[model samples]
Target: MNVTLLMAITINGFVAGQDDDTEWVKDIDALYKMTAEAGVAIMGKRTYDECVKYNAFPYKGALNIVMTHDKTLLTKSTDDVIFTDATPQGALQLLEQKGFDHALVIGGGNINGSFLKAGLINEIILDIHPMVMAKGIHLFEGDFPYQQLELMSFTKINDDLLQVKYRVKNNYENS
Candidate 1:
């Protein structure tokens, strides 16, 4: 399986505010398109909560996998959705067993941290918006060792939005 990390962060590398506010993320159409193309989305519980808070859960056209220790969420698992307590490697293994070819790790810091820390993400695409949140959620929130990224490419998504793609150096291989 090809695992990719897709997220939007401020120029200062914050993904959300203290209140879990994402009013700064404005490229929904682009985000939706890229995510849908992946066929599967893996996210943390908080990211799932935020999506539901805005009435946008069970992302259409893709299987949604949420990682959480909440056993109640297991009941929600179906052919199209999965709520698992799997670790980053475990989650990828599950997806591979299910025959998914590509998957996207849609974020909330800890999830990103786990995947990156496990060296499971082959690529990362960050939609860097032209804004700054002094104090909020950092891109990788959990404890992880240093990672090196090799620039793949970058493009101007809009007037002020820059989309940058990077490969996790030393770990980017055909998955």
Candidate 2:
């Protein structure tokens, strides 16, 4: 299965403010479009909550999986959402069984790190916003072994936004 870790981060690499404020994020339409095209998307509980703040729920026509240990975090059921405590590996397995050849890993930070640490991510597309925060959540939360990437493509979304795509290199155990 193909998995892409897609996110937006500050120039200094912060995904959110120290207070967990995501207002600095811009160019959400592109993100939404990418999510829509993926057919399957997964994110951590916190990332899901942040997305709800902007009412980007349901992710129409896509299977939106919320990875969380606490079931109660999900207030109620939704048509296109599946709340699961599955590990990244287990979640990918489920997606594979469902015949989804590709999935997108949407995140705040920790979830991205988990997939990277597990060697499950194949590509990363970052929408880099031009800003820097001295203290804030990073693009990848926990400590992970260094992984290399090969730049695939990049484009300027606007005067302030630059989107870059990278293929994960030397990230798999068998590589």
Candidate 3:
């Protein structure tokens, strides 16, 4: 299956910060709309829970896969949503089994870190917000091996947000 990482980071280079208001809701909502239109959505436990809380709606009719340690918490349903406690590797395995052509990796830090460390991500779609916070979680927790990216496209969405799409360079043998 083809893997893609979709995330939004603040211009200051933080994901989550001291204040909960980092325009993340708007960014995430935009991502959710895009992914939902694409027919599948995958996210970390924290992000999934946050979406559930904020949206006040279950991801019904859409494939909602949650990455977490507690697999038992996931409901059993194939028609709508399915949860798996798999890390990036496990999730990719499951997606492969299900014959998924593409998957979106949504996260704050840990999720992105796992994919980058494992060299599994194929593309990155980042929504850059134009505000800086003093402290917050970054997209990369620490300095991992550098991976080159080729800018595919970019669009200016309003004055405060920039949507950039990049393909991970030579990260995948067949890609």
Candidate 4:
């Protein structure tokens, strides 16, 4: 399956403010369009909560999977939205079983790191915003294994936004 880790972060690499404020990450129609085209999307609980708090829950036109240990979310599961405690791989497996060949790993931070650290991510497309925060949530929450990425493309989404795409190198490809 093809998995893409797609996110928007500050130039300094913060995805949200220290207090989890993501007001700066708003209204990027490009991001919404990309994830929607993927047919399926998975995100961590915190990310899901933020999306909800911002009135952006249940990404339209895609199967939205929320990964968390909070089983109560199961009650909210439906044909289009699934709340589960599945691992990143497990979530993607579910997507594959549903006949999806590709998915987008939407994120806040920790989820992005988990998928990358597990070597499950195939591509990363970052929407680089204009500001920098001294203290905040990073692009990747935990320590990463330092796999390299091949530069695929980089261009302006607008005057203040720049989008960069990279293909994650597999273990053998790095050799």
Leading candidate by lDDT: 1
Candidate 1 lands at a TM-score of 0.95
Q: Could you give candidate 2's per-residue lDDT for residues 11-84 as a string of tens digits?
A: 88888997798888888877888888999889998888877877877677689999898858555546578888
In candidate 4, stretches whose alpha carbon ends up further than 4 angstroms from where it belongs are 171-175
Ranking by TM-score: 1, 4, 2, 3
lDDT by residue for model 3 over 16-110, one digit each (tens)? 77644444535555776767665566776776666776773345434677777764656554555667766678877876787777877777577
lDDT value for model 4: 0.86
Candidate 3 ranges with C-alpha deviation above 4 Å: 19-29, 71-78, 170-175
Residues 1-175 of candidate 4 have per-residue lDDT tens digits of 9999899899999999978978898556777888789988889999998888889888998889888888688777998899988788888888888889999999868999889878999999988989989998888888766788899999987788888999988744533
Evaluated at residue 173, the lDDT of candidate 3 is 46
lDDT of 1: 0.89
TM-score of each: 0.95, 0.92, 0.82, 0.93
Best by TM-score: 1
Error of 1 at 149 (Å): 0.8
lDDT of each: 0.89, 0.87, 0.71, 0.86
Cα TM-score of candidate 4: 0.93
Better of 2 and 3 by lDDT: 2
Question: Between which residue pairs do clashes occur in model 2?
Answer: none
lDDT value, residue 43 of candidate 2: 91
lDDT of 1 by residue, 1-175 (tens): 7889999999999999879989889888788888789889999999999999998888888999999999899777898889999888898899899888789999989999988878888999999988887788989988767777999999998898899999988643543
